[model samples]
Target: MNVLVTGGAGYIGAHVVRVLAQHGHTPIILDDLRSASYERIGDFQHEHVALEDTSKVMAVFQKYQPEAIVHLAGSISVRESVQTPEKYWANNLGAGMSLLLACARFPVRIFLFSSSAAVYGNAVETPIRENAILEPTSPYGSSKLAFEHTLHRSAQALGMCSIALRYFNAAGAHTAWGVGEQHDSEEHLIPKVIRALLTAQPVQVYGNDYPTPDGTCIRDYIHVVDLAEAHVLTLENEYLGNQHNFNVGTGEGYSVLEIISAIATRLSVTPQITFLSRRPGDPPRLIADPSALLSHVGWKPVHSSLQEIVNSAVEWELVRC
Candidate 1:
């Protein structure tokens, strides 16, 4: 399958591209290089084209004529989205519109979206299900959900099968493949902890007084390799018609303190910590019930163990240092 992967140079996208290649699928990268790191891209065959450039996007379709599109391009910072929603609305929704229009006009079959678990904001339930309520508190999540509706409409009317994988805390790296998480301003917990370890700095533990076993906020952390494999399995499935949603996770929750301890143990060091007040909208526990993915696409997380995730991330960070 000749697959067009938008944002193919990104942290998750890079892993997805390699996984697709490993499965004998041709992944044609289409990244604007705005937020993507060239080092992570390696030697994959790619085109420097933005989705907002309709002419170039159409040209890409005409050139490769991809059978499927793994749409991963977007601005994905919740904090920044709160400060400037127009940017999210423009890039995530607006540019997404341009791509959807192109998909409608093209002969593309499978449209796999890289959606986030942030769409379910501050849920009152643990192990969130697919049928969980849709109430995104941030503009980032809103943009992703809004685009999902448009994709659903396109699937119903245009006859293209779309699947939205609501990812929960995509961490770790595919260091063996020479691609890992590298953001300009690090936000994810694992990478932040790794950086603190390398620099011998104190990692701020927010809301250590939460109602949990360790008195810290808990979240589901899925390895990037497992997350990428989930994408390939869904794309390869023959299920047709309608837009489907699945939670891509290990269905296990790890508290923030637990994650910090895991990384520190992996690196053989004692972590410096400072407990602080919880951030607004910080949930006590947020985990995914990924049974839907297993039943529908025969997908199950294989490399999402906390130790392996920490080791992979630590190896990649060590290389960077």
Candidate 2:
């Protein structure tokens, strides 16, 4: 299958592109390189196009004529989204509209969207199910959920088969692929810990007094490779139709302290720590019920263990250093 992966130069998108290539499929990347590095994307064929530009997007779709598309391009910072809702609304929602319009014009078959667990703000249930109420506390989550709603409506009317994988805390990196997470102003916990360890800087622990084990917030951390494989599997299935949503996670939770300890152990270095108050809109615990994905697609997370996730991240950070 010929695939067009938006944001393919990103941390997760690069891994998805590699997974498609490993499965004997050709993937053309469309990335603006606004917050990604081409070095991580390696040797894949790519086009420099912004999702906001419909003409450029249309040209890429026309040129590639991809059988499927994996959309992962968006501004994905919850804190920043709170500060500037317009940016999230414009980029996440507006860019998604442009992409869907281009797809409608070009007539693509499969669309695999990179949705988020943020749609289920402060889950009322232990392991968040697909049926959980979507009350996004941040504009980032709202933007993603809005796009998902549009996708469902479009699929019904346009005969487009789409799948929105609402994933939780994406962490870790490709074990052997050498493509790992690299954000300009790194905000993700795991990456931040790795940077602190490498630079011998203080690891800022946000909201250490949350009501959870070890007095810190807990979240589901899925490996990049595992998440990438889910995308490939969703696209490979010929029976995919209309619109479907799945939570791609390990169905387990790890606390912030646990993650810090794991990173410290893996790197054989103790991290300087400073506790701070909880950030606004941060849920205490957010886990997923991946049973739906397993039953529907036979997809199970492989590298979900905390040790494995931290190990991979430590290795990648060492390489970067």
Candidate 3:
């Protein structure tokens, strides 16, 4: 499969590109290197094209004529989105619109979206379902959800098959492939803790006084490799029709303190931790049902255990250092 991977140079996109290559598919990367690091892209065949650049995007499409498009390009920061909403709206929604329009006009058939769990911000329930109310609190999440809605309508209009895989915490690295998480500004917990722990710095635990048993906020951490596998399965499946949505998670929740403890145990170091006030718009607990993905998509998480996740991240961080 000749696939056009938007944001194929970034953290998650790199992992997905690696997975696609391992699965015997050619990934023609399209990344502007705006927030992406070139060192992380390694030897993947890619083009310097922004998502909103229709001419450049069309040129890449003409070159590859990709059978599928794994759309991973976008601005992805809840806090940053809150601070600069116009940036989020432009990059996330606007760039996505460009690709969707191209697909509608071009020969591209399949579109796999990298959606977010932030779409269900401050959920009313613990284990969020596919049918759960989508009340995104931040512009980032809203932008992703808005693109999904457009994807549905555009798929019907273009006669293309689209799937939006709503990801939870996509942590860890491709330990075997040696391509792991590498961000210009580290925000995800696993990498942040790994960097801090290695440097003998204290990691701040935000608001450990929540209602949960550990009093810290709980989140569903999905291994990057597992997420890549889900994309491979869904994208390769020949039964996709108009549109589909799946919440990609392990159906497990780990609190902030638990993650710290796991990192401490895995790395054999006493982590220096500091508790701070909770960041607003953060849910106390957010787990996934994930039943729809298994039954419908024939997929389930195989590398999402907390110990394995922490271990992979620690290994990648150690190797990079």
Candidate 4:
């Protein structure tokens, strides 16, 4: 089966591309190389075109004739989205609409989206489910949720099947593939904490007055490898549906202080920290109830342990330095 993965050169996208190849599938990458580095993808078949370039995107669809599409392209920063909402709407929802239009013209069977847990903003419950109310506080989450609706409607109208994996907090790395979470502007907690520790910089901890135990934000973190594997399993199932939203995470929640402590323990370094007010659009706790994914496809987190997550990230940071 030939699969077309947008943003395939990105952190999680690269891992998905590798996993797909290991499963005996042809993985073709479609990336703009704007926020992603081309070196990450190596020699895999790819097209250096943005989704907004409908002509080129259609050309790639015509050329590869992919049976499945794993859409991972778009803006993904919550804080930035809060600052500049137009960018999020244009890239996340706008460019995605173009891809959906192009997919309708092809024989695409399965469409897998990279959604986020932010959709369920400040959930009243601890472990969030797919059926939870979606009241995204940030433009980033709103954009993702809006595109999900578009995908669902488009899939049903065009007789296509789609799955949106609402990822909680994706951490760790796949250094074996020479790729890890190397964002141009790092915002994810794990990498930021590790970088601060390595350089002896004071890492800022947001919101120490939340309703949590330590008064810090809590989240469900999933390793990139495990997250990529879930995408492969979704394709294997070839689920027949308009759009199925699954929480791709471990059923455990970790606080910000807890995560820092775990990373510090693994790297054997004392982290310098500075507590600050909470950033807007950030939920106090965003833990996922991933039972739906497990029951649906027998998927499990094999390499998502906290120790493994921290160790892999530390190794990647060390190698990167």
Instruction: Evaluate all candidate structures by whole-model CA lDDT and list the values in order.
Output: 0.89, 0.89, 0.87, 0.91
Cα RMSDs, all models: 1.1, 1.2, 1.2, 1.0
Please provide, for model 3 over 135-196, each residue's C-alpha lDDT reduced to its tens digit, 9 standing for 90 to 100. 99999999999999988888878888988999999988876676788777878888888788
Which of the two, 3 or 4, has more TM-score? 4
**Model 3, which residues run further than 4 Å from truth?**
none
Candidates 1 and 2, the one with greater lDDT: 2
Which is the leading candidate under lDDT?
4
| Candidate No. with top TM-score | 4
Which residue runs does candidate 2 get wrong by more than 4 Å? none
**Candidate 1, which segments miss by more than 4 Å at Cα?**
none
For candidate 4, the per-residue lDDT at 293 reads 91
lDDT of 1 by residue, 76-180 (tens): 898889999999989988897767778777778889998989899888787899889989889999999998888888777878888998999999887778888
Query: What is the per-residue lDDT of model 4 for residues 23-111, given as tens digits with 9 covering 90 to 100?
Result: 99999999989998879889899899999888889999999999999999988899999899999999999998778878888869989
Cα deviation of 105, candidate 4, in Å: 1.3
Model 4 lDDT vs. the true structure? 0.91
Output the lDDT of residue 143, model 3: 96
Estimate TM-scores for all models. Answer: 0.97, 0.97, 0.97, 0.98
